[model samples]
Target: MFKPAEGPVRLPSGQRYLGLDLGSKTIGLALSDTGHRIASPYQTLARKKFSADAAELQRIVAKEGVAALVLGLPVNMDGTEGPRCQATRAFARNISQLMPLPIALWDERMSTMAVQRMMTDEADLSRARRAELVDKLAASYILQSYLDWVGGQPT
Candidate 1:
């Protein structure tokens, strides 16, 4: 029964946040700085059984001192919730049962495409290399978007 968080994300002092971009086959991860002002690409996790994936995430949360989770919500361009959006919500709900961290869903339309374009236009990375890096980079983009939004809020 987990719901996407409303308003600004608040956490205990000294704790960071974890950003997740969940794909059908892989999960991209990003980590925020202790001050929650910056997000960096972390790692990618291959999809596995729900229990195994949750266990790994729990372990990472403990190790990384993560206080909250920002999950990319793949809404359609028309602002409609598609199957992918439903799946992401389901994952959030299920993960909430396993871990008590607050979860926020950020609209992720065009996130991966934007990252791919950046890699091609600026980084000039090869297709194969971009494939290897896109997911994690996209996760960073998503997390950075959230951080920027928070930063713009009136304190």
Candidate 2:
């Protein structure tokens, strides 16, 4: 049986990390700098079977030299885990078994909402465009929050 990978090795110079926002229909992706200071939306992956998704993620990990993965944990406003959060955890567990990468779950409450608002208010994007881009933007938001928290900054 395959065991899950251990936690990430702390680097002298923090290595680049990947962030994921796992949705029912799509998966949002983000990448952080080696310095772990900034995170940017990388792309959105249309949801597919677990095996295929894992293969694609493995490719990204190999190509990007990713040191760890930050998974967004969806939570209710009351700070409780919900069905979505459980789903995200299951995804992470399975991915860890395959890739053995260090993974941490970050709170993602309001991330999607914040991204939608940003698209509407700043970009003035229409609903359709916002819908198309919100997942990746939410991934970015989740990653940025994690980075901030890990670096001892307020999220």
Q: What TM-score would each prediction reach against the true structure?
A: 0.97, 0.89
| Residue lDDT tens for model 1, 1-155 | 78789887877669988999999999999999998889999999999999999999999999999999999999999999999999999999999999998999999999999999999999999999998888889999999999899878887
On a 0 to 100 scale, what is the lDDT of residue 93 in model 1? Answer: 98
User: lDDT per prediction?
Assistant: 0.93, 0.84
- Give lDDT tens digits, candidate 2, residues 1-155: 32333443233455778889999999999998888889999999999999999999999988887988888888999998889988988898788888877788887989999998889999999888888888888998998888777777333
Candidate 2 structure, TM-score to reference: 0.89
Q: List residue ranges in candidate 2 displaced over 4 A.
A: 1-14, 153-155
